[model samples]
Target: VGHTIESTVLALESIAATDNIAKNLGIEAGETIYYVKRIRYIDGKILCLEESYYRQSIVPYLNREIVEQSIFEYLETALQLNIGFSDMYMHVGKLSAESARHLGLTEGDPGLTIETVFHLTNGRPFDYSVITYHYEHSQFVVQANGLYL
Candidate 1:
């Protein structure tokens, strides 16, 4: 699908990390982290809402300008960070009131949620994200190739 995609920054700030987020990133509680929230659009239609937290010590230069583009690209190219891997969990659940409002849906509407933790080449967790896709606009396609015995 060759369609245009856009990201609008809803929020970008540096804040103290919670215990859960700190644990996920292997950092101490109350450590500084960069929080980013964005609403995604595909062909000018709302598509998803994504929120992310990045370890400030690892990504010190994170800013709204950088996030409006691609953080992964910035990390890999500008910062010369080697992205290792990510652990992802996906599920279908009812949207919270805040998430629903952002997506123009009613509270408790069904939506797809994907949570991910991104790691660096040395296996240090760098970023964690939760993305909620609009139920009506969500489509996922995965392809695998391997040698058969």
Candidate 2:
């Protein structure tokens, strides 16, 4: 028996504004934005929750299928956007009522929180995301090789 990671877009919408979304995306107040939320699963078991913010100015076209499938792939292949780098921050946080319900976990459950800001090759920030993963379903591994000269 074996399992594989699966993902599905739970919600995709174009909203005028949201709580702290503009702050995270570094856009002006009231600017148009797209909020994409999805859940990860492994063999029908909940793994983690990921929410991403995309600015309309950066990605002019937004659609459900683009998000439902793979935003990164669409950005690179379809949009031809160059991915420069990403800055990430990780910590522990409690899941909100809504998020916990979606993940089928107890409300206020502790989980690992990862925030990332992706920059384009042109040096402009394009996306900001926050991902939460429970301890039971997640692990962090770092591989190293070679020594300093």
Q: lDDT of each prediction vs. the true structure? A: 0.91, 0.82
Model 2, residue 10: distance off in Å is 2.0
Give the least accurate 10-residue stretch of model 2, judged by summed lDDT.
Answer: 140-149
RMSD from true fold, candidate 1: 2.5
- What's the lDDT for residue 24 in model 2? 69
Error of 1 at 46 (Å): 1.6
Clashing pairs in 2: none
- Write candidate 1's Cα lDDT for 27-120 as tens digits: 9999999999999889888899999999988898888788887789999999899999899899898999999999999999999999999999
Clash statistics: count for each candidate:
0, 0
Clashing pairs in 1: none
